[model samples]
Target: MTSFQQLLTDLGNKSLSVLDRNIPKSAYVPLDLSVTNAALKEVDVSSASKLGEYINRHIAMNEGKVAYGGYLEKRGIYNRSDYFNQQNPETERNIHLGLDLWIAAETPIYAPLEGEVHSFQNNTNFGDYGPTIILKHIINTVEFYTLYGHLSLASIENLQIGDVFRKGEQIATLGDASINGDYAPHLHFQIIKDIQQYSGDYPGVASQKDVVFYQENCPDPNLLLRL
Candidate 1:
């Protein structure tokens, strides 16, 4: 049986671009809610260790999930409430299993490794994940996949499944409110292994009961990005 450490080592060996050096050395910055003045008007999240909790609460109220993404149900801060498994299969629920990099629209997004385009779709709707993309990657011969959501409409215009993408290759641009499911532009990234018979849209967030499945299927992206 494969072990988690082995998985981590295998993933570490995969072709991935470190976000640290991708941006200009001076331009690279930590995620600070205060920098943009959200702290002044909203909650203060300057402390790094406390950031996660702040963000989790922010999403729970603002987006209905601990992680930021498409909340299919409708029960959150946006006056929207979407409990993950309320109406979905027994397998789906509102639990967050990934880290979200919130930034402005059109932020360049790149492939983390050499992989094939597994699927793409325009998950259009209010509070939806527009222009989503999933890539299948094989590392150490173990099969797994990564998901990219809330992308610009033009991102996948000329792309197709089975197309090959190299590490650092520009895959898409961040979407604005009009096309990105109506929230601040950001990247909704998740690592997925078993898709569990879902397509175009898999649960970006799961419920507490389903946390173990997501944790195993969607390993912390920090292992790859360290972002």
Candidate 2:
């Protein structure tokens, strides 16, 4: 493993959930796309409303407040032609790079560690992160970045670069389907060892060919979430 990867593993042991502790472990459910299911296979996941209803059903069935997306999940939700070619599933960017915490709109999101706002942007593409924030952090002198995507547009208002935030501080709130790149309400949290010259926005999903590289750059968010 890379030294950075080892550092992330170490941080995981000491990190806290990005959500409030009062939410309870029972409020979280692991969502796996690898399972063989007709709902995922046949449903129009690209539509925010459709996906929101699907996620709501999952929450209802499990009695959880949020649904968690596993690392490296082959999510078919990015099949929109604007984001990827619907004609070619093989070339689609369907593999999830970040860990998604699906929840209701306007739900508050917290910082898992002490950091400063590195950058923020409104990536207003049809299937893009509506308003995203990237925070820069240095732990044990190991510099890394944390990305928060699909957030409320208002979260970026009055924000400036280098804005400091404490651990567990309220950083942003979840955005609904209409605003959050037309997807269900969720927080796409990712860790980047190197941002590769990107600012405010980075790829949260990877095509098959680039998945291995992203796997190295963006480690499993569960390391920090611990849920």
Q: What is the C-alpha RMSD of each candidate to the true structure, in Å?
A: 8.2, 1.8
What is the per-residue lDDT of model 2 for residues 1-227, given as tens digits with 9 covering 90 to 100?
Answer: 77887777777788487877689877898776543556686667767788778888888899998899758887655656457544665567878889989888899999989999999999888888899999999999888999999999889998999999999899999898778888888998999989889999999888888898999989988877778
Which run of 10 residues does model 1 get worst, by summed lDDT? 70-79
Candidate 1 lDDT, tens digit per residue, 54-135?
A: 6545554553322322222212222243433355444444445655666557878888887889889999755568899988
- TM-scores for all candidates? 0.70, 0.93
Q: Report the lDDT of model 1 for residue 84.
A: 33
How many residue pairs clash per model?
A: 12, 0
lDDT score of residue 54 within candidate 2:
81
| Best by the TM-score measure | 2
- Per-residue lDDT value at 43 in model 2: 61
User: lDDT per prediction?
Assistant: 0.63, 0.84
Instruction: State which candidate has the highest lDDT.
Output: 2
